[model samples]
Target chain A: MNLTILIVMAVLTGVLGSPYVTDTDVTPGSDSAGMSAHPNSVPEAADGTEVFHEEGVVEEEGVEEDVMATGELNPSHYPAQRAANVVKHYLNTRYGSPYRWVGLHKVHSANAEEVAESGRKYHLEISVQEMTGNTTEKCSAEVLFPALENQRSPQVQASCEALLTANTTAQEEALYQQYRRNHTLLSGHNLPDSYGHIDPDMKPLWHLGGVASSFVMLKESTENTLYNMAQVANVTQLETENDQLRFNYHVLLHDMVSQEIIHWKLLVTWSPAEGVKVLQMEELPKCEHCEVPPKPN
Target chain B: MKALLILIVLMNLDKNKCFAFLSFSDQVLSITAKTQEQVELLKNVSTQYETVLWQPVSPEYIKEEEPVHLSPSAFAQSFASRFCFRVLLDNTNEMIELQTRNDSTDPRSSSSYYERYHSLEDIYYWINRTTQEHPEMVKVVLIGSSYEKRPLYALKISVGEKQDKKAIWIDCGIHAREWISPAFCMWFSLSYYNQNQDITHILNHMDVYVLPVMNPDGYKYTWTTNRMWRKNRSYSTDSSCVGVDLNRNFDANWCTEGASDKPCSEIYCGAFPESEPESEAVANFLRSHKDSVQLYLTIHSYSQMLLFPYSCTLDEAENHNELLVMAQEAAQKIRRYYRNTYKYGAGGKTIYLAPGGSDDWAYNLGIKYSFTFELQDRGRYGFLLPPSHISKACNEALIAVKTIALRVIEKTQAPQ
Candidate 1:
């Protein structure tokens, strides 16, 4: 369990984002110029409205031409496109998506002949479209697992129950292992204070039966969170005609570990596909001729 | 003269050896008093020293610089009436509210205020409001948190049912200095749901995940202190340097080439493969969703390129032909907009081999449709792409991404 937690934290940190530590003397509105720096001022945009600053443009105009001419040489002359609209969309959406590698030289070299002949450069973009070929039956949450979101429709709940009933043999060990790894349940390191501190060493010594799922709520006012338990009262299963599998999780107001009034709630529904390995460590391959030479690069 | 005589005596005593010493700020003396043989020998020694001093420092110290002009968006903001374009289709008002925070421009010799653009609070407010307005298709998720505890978010674009849908992942803002990456990522999300309404078909079939900024810490740092930070702020106890090139922190081939081990280097690979938690988080998420995530698009900037996998080595991937074709098609679409050209091909074969790249890693992990896009005007605008071009770059990229997404879906749906 501990190893799983450590692995989960490691993976979570990698997937979610890296930690940022900052110390700065500059205050957002500390400048003596105040809000009057711009002649035209307006209230901040209402939700969904794009907010644009005036001075940033003026500054951009002054340097755009110069940058276009010499930016290649200097590289510092580019502009920053602040698209609040796009960011807003992301903050409202979930599931998204680095790294550098070499093999660039060989690829470029191989394509050089083709590129020269065509006098054209290449690019790759992905466009996903819904398929009309096949269909899958909807599943209900109550039928599939131990619990369901409070607000889910009866029909949807029924579908999930059906999914759970069909897959009774699907043990909860994999799911628990995955969750533990994702959360670093056994890692000795304490959870970051940002997520509401949890002692890595704290052991919850109890048998959680029937209840096949869990939700963690961090207390805002105090250093306490709420953990709710429920037994699977009823369930139904819906088997999909297609080979693909999917599932969803739910979080309710009562799931809050704290009673304080918070601005919002985060509900995550995770569905791990069958036969998928939660965590696998693979050995990195080496180049047969890749020798560690004394090339001072 | 006495010292010279003594030196000569010492030299004679040690007959086989010879040496000449010169000191003080500047002194020019003739060796005419010495024998021709001695003079010639001293001249040779002096020439050797001159050659050594003239040798250029190795590893060619070429410093990188950002585009000098304010980006087009900044231009529009300055002259709102003249250059301003509607950033969002939902924005009916002509006026734009300006945040009066100097966090965008405060340059303290000591501290960096990387919190430029809108603050996190402002960003969240904007997202919340946007979702409230358009709750039908736009679902938001705080995918992860940055080093500073700022939430990393993704906007999911889906129409009808989200179950069993193919997923495409687009992450921007990996190199914090490349501010445009996040912008493009954001812009694409808005455009998909707003301007391009037919995208519902695309969304219905696939859930598109867009992460605007991956390296929030380094990105904030870029705004505040160093304008060119290209890594995540990960502290190494062994060194004072506090960052790792997130791009080089993936596990594809796990740091073999086109990366640096030096902590101070811009492209420094972390202590180990997947050393940075942020990269790990992203990798783990993608791995978990590998079945559905058919297309992995990691957006980057300055160089308009559409790259694919096997970045760690020169070997061609199993789907090399398909990836190359897709890349070529996308590059051509980008060229139609402007004279700007973009290169596309396999990662290793097109450019330098870079190990531990996310795209390559994803490709290796069964997500064959993985791509890394380097967007915009060759190097003209570089990281400081103008706002005006943002639409062009984003539009071109959007077209390309949609094009590839469509292609991949068609291929997937085709007779197996």
Candidate 2:
């Protein structure tokens, strides 16, 4: 066989092995390519200084070395930890939940297998890696979960009603937490650009943008416990002179009680003079004419 | 007063004559023919608003054959006779008696008779009775309350069970007008109690929860004013429109596709995911029990279909194989039992992409098995599934559910 064909065949052969095989378990000694033992996995030495391979695939001699190794945090670390905690708390609070795979199909059948595979992928993505990375960094805080803290307040209900009617909020943004957690289990689906930035690993980290939507405040003001959804659009991320990344995103906000809908598209870029700034809001022109309707006489 | 008098006269007139004759009441004599014609121009309106009814014109007027229409006792007898085993109608007879008509234009409303389901009370009564009789396997819980403060209840059924067990949830009536959706849940519950021993074993090992009438206010309104409302009656102060499509109100790819922001639209997704009280209650409940909720089935109507999750987008899910196999098996069982053809595939792939749906939301939350069932004939009957087909449809659905349940028990048991 030709070299190209031979290489392709070899790669396929390597991939087709048992799925349960782990990276470290499969690749040993000189064969290790991209495997990196997590910091927690490494044993602590007598001194604070620790020796490690720059390439994550290998573990070399450990000696007390003085080098600032400031690695960027795993994008999924914060959200995943929070999610795990939240889920655990959820289970504890509710006692227990009923489980179902695919309610309509029988097991060991074609559809059942597909469902099983989807579940497997779900674990790999959410439980293991961040599937949806930061799609947009224009927002200051990502909206993690949306909940009405004052569940019985009339004003909150009225505001929700207003938002619902105006069509300002999209349902997707409103239920970001539920959808984000569930998206991993869904068949292969991709996240929108506004939520997070795509890392080298292709996983979307949670941009502060998603966390902005679910803010709850004891009192309504410029700032409080719950931040307003519109504030995220005003946020801008910094950039260096050589490599400047621009962010364009779609933001959806909905108030259930008032039936108000608010949708805005934002573009933000970095500039040496201004540091970071918003370029445009796509929905401004469209919404200019959509003034709030007059209340009944 | 004058309009009322004329309406009464029209009601008294022979049905055929009323259609043929356009009466110019002397009181309305001042108006010109153009104006008078405009007054009588309107023919039929949806189940919500009031409208004038026209007499049948030959073939058009001929009423189609009604499906199975059994009185409460007769329904019981029919179930016993048809199954040739035990019929569990007494357990859910109150629900059968609480009937609502699918025909909104009919002057004779189903609510006037003993058939239409009037309120959440009626639905709960039936669920409670069904579970009570089958205490060995069934248990009930009041999950939460609706926007209008109606209690939302879910029935858990298993043959050999205790409360602490893995389970599947089947929620119906997201769209209020689809009466058959809730009926299917009732039927499934009853069947688990009365039918096959295998199902009993599966239930004993695994719990099955059913939510009938997710949108109670809209459902109650369907019985009272309108018979075609497809949303929850959550009051929106900004606009006169007062409902949100609960089915389109879930958090799965929520507003991405096949949904509307306008509250008046048929497929209006609420302002946000879990924005409505009904959806929030369900979501909170599910979130709390995320690990145990292995399978989720949201029942809807008209189309005979079995759909999987990720309805918000046209992407394959992680558990596509297992879901596909299970779906096929369920479809096959349904066919064998009732000879009904059910189309099965991924939600986004099989049908148009729909966001903010329960099945998709449940799937996203790591419950690998999520499905939406559009029960009965495609659209000939629409939400108007005849009473005649209830038993057969229920039986078929039960078989399909059992197949899934048994598989779930096996899968949950097999290793991790």
Candidate 3:
């Protein structure tokens, strides 16, 4: 009876002891699996700069708790997890936006094992929902995480930096503030209202052009302020010469009372001699992908 | 029961078959063809992939980089790359879908003019209701019937002493896809009834005749069958093709230049001058009331232009200077009020030489202030101006029309 029991125990152990076993404990210094086993694994930093690492075995019960604690899986834990984490981090840091996580897909490759062994590409597709003004925008981004630890952070940093530099809303707001200051200064000085009579000192930044057709200057006594809520959506530099710079900016204008929004492309040519001249302003056609955000109840 | 089931299945099959030819994936490209070769290439590619040209007369009008809208399939990508173009609208289907979504607004309950595009039936109902509600000022006159026997109605709006007053004849939707044209007419009529201060003098001095939809069948077809159909639904001698461009079927310069004889062409002038019953009926009515009709205004869209007679030729009209001065003044007034620019000149020089225009015909018939307004946009949305823009478009046109009408009244009142 003892011999028979020993044989049965050996058979059971054999069945559950393989590498493909479902409940195998993650061993230390094993590069194949586990978050803490990676060569570049570092402890969690207070500034959220270091790559993520999870302690203990990746048990079935712990997965949900781990996900909740970390917001997402640690990049070093799984080959696909790195890409998704990088993309999420990139969007979160870049826009500082509240977004709905739509989907994350791990792209399969025939040479995935080899690629992971080389510590190179980890391809993933991620989708998120964002709101621009009143419109909800669904954006899909494909991320390919680089293997080098030093390069990874810089890649994300570079992308965020590029987006920050090209932030048109901030630029337009600055320009508008400058315009208002100039307007106040000119009005205070009591300049003439006719063409060619603008103050020479203020000619570099602001000049009098025809008011856009879609905008109406309301009477001050009406208490209905015609606020120029305009944002530069896009800018294209058409020509650059020694003295003059010609550029076109697509601006989105929104009215407070009417709740009317219109997109217009304005061509502007600037030079020291000519000051700033609005060459043309035309309304852009409606876009299918764009939607006005719903009013909050 | 089996027969009914078979009929239902067959109907589904028929619907699927119709959609097989109509691709929802087709894209609308705005090509600025500068050379004859590029224009010819466009025509060639159009043959392979189904295309609908939107602006300018034809391929011949591509000399100065004129904008042309072409709906081409993905297969034409290689052909499209050879030319310089902008994707004005990506998907034609999506555009139509967007324009037609929940567009039904009952004109009765809506105190303000229904800004969204309305169906033909809704427009007709609005017309009938307006006349019925204001029997004193509004009178519905059945001008004629379309080829499909749709009654052509015109509203004669006059508040008081209609006998001796001069009249301003305003017609819209001469080309069916120009939906804003008809919308302007409806808005103008409603605003006049409400005694809009700008047009109050014009209404008090003269009667206004508004034929809101000239080509009813074509307008209905645009809503139902094809969104881009531009002519009246009149069967030609050839049984395969249909429609006659009513603007080109008028008597002035009849089929001379910038018009076609082919039945399949968009600008096909009919078999003879005033061939389409719609045009013939309008011409007959104008002829009968030539003495009282001092000014004729026909509204079309996409180009902000106010053009006067002689669209058939380069030659100036006898009252060219007077018409030019009046149009300039009207444009200036519109600019000052709305800050929108409107180009004004003789039709042939300002726009294209489209021969048989109603304005030209009216000018020939002795209506000195005959003008055509290409309203609102400058070819950005082309024929599809959204409902939100209706107020602006109508307001600007209102200011210009009031200016012209006041000028016409002044010109007529001055002693010879």
All candidates: TM-score: 0.44, 0.44, 0.46
Give per-residue lDDT, candidate 3, residue B225. 53
lDDT of 2: 0.45
Q: At residue B347, what lDDT does model 3 achieve? A: 76
lDDT of 1 by residue, B1-416 (tens): 22223223322331111122211001111111134443343334334332110111211221122101111111121222221111110011001111111243323211111112332344466567657767877788776677667777777767775477889999988887666677677656655544222254467678888877788887766555544356888778887767887888888777576777777655678899878877877887888888889999999875567888877787888988888788777666544422235667666654456787889888888998999998864422245443434544565677688778878888886532
lDDT of 2 by residue, A1-297 (tens): 132332222122110000111111211222222111211111111111111101111111111111111122121222212222222222111211101000011111100011221210011111111102101111011112322442321111101111112221242233333323443322111121111112222111112233222222111211012111322223332332243334454444322212233455555433222223335545443242343332111
**What C-alpha lDDT values do all the predictions have?**
0.42, 0.45, 0.54
lDDT of 3 at B186: 86
Better of 2 and 3 by lDDT: 3
> TM-score of A-chain in each prediction?
0.17, 0.22, 0.24
What is candidate 2's lDDT per residue for B1-416, written digit by digit as tens? 22223223432332211111111100010111123222232111111122111122111222322111111111121111221111111111122222221344224332212123235566777777667777766678888999999889888665542557787898988888678778777656654543333554665577778888888888876665544456898877776677888878988777765788887666788788889999999999899888788888888875567788767876778988788788888886555433456767676655456788888888889888788887774332245444434544555566677678778888886643
Candidate 3 deviant stretches above 4 angstroms: A1-297, B1-112, B414-416
Question: Residue A135 in model 1: shift from native, Å?
Answer: 57
What local lDDT does model 3 show for residue B406? 82
The segments of candidate 1 whose C-alpha lies over 4 angstroms from its true place after superposition are A1-297, B1-122, B195-198, B337-339, B414-416
For every model in order, what is the iRMS?
Answer: 31.6, 34.1, 34.2
Going through the candidates in order, the fraction of native interface contacts each one reproduces equals 0.00, 0.00, 0.00
Q: Lowest lDDT 10-mer window, candidate 2 chain A?
A: A98-107
Top candidate, metric lDDT: 3
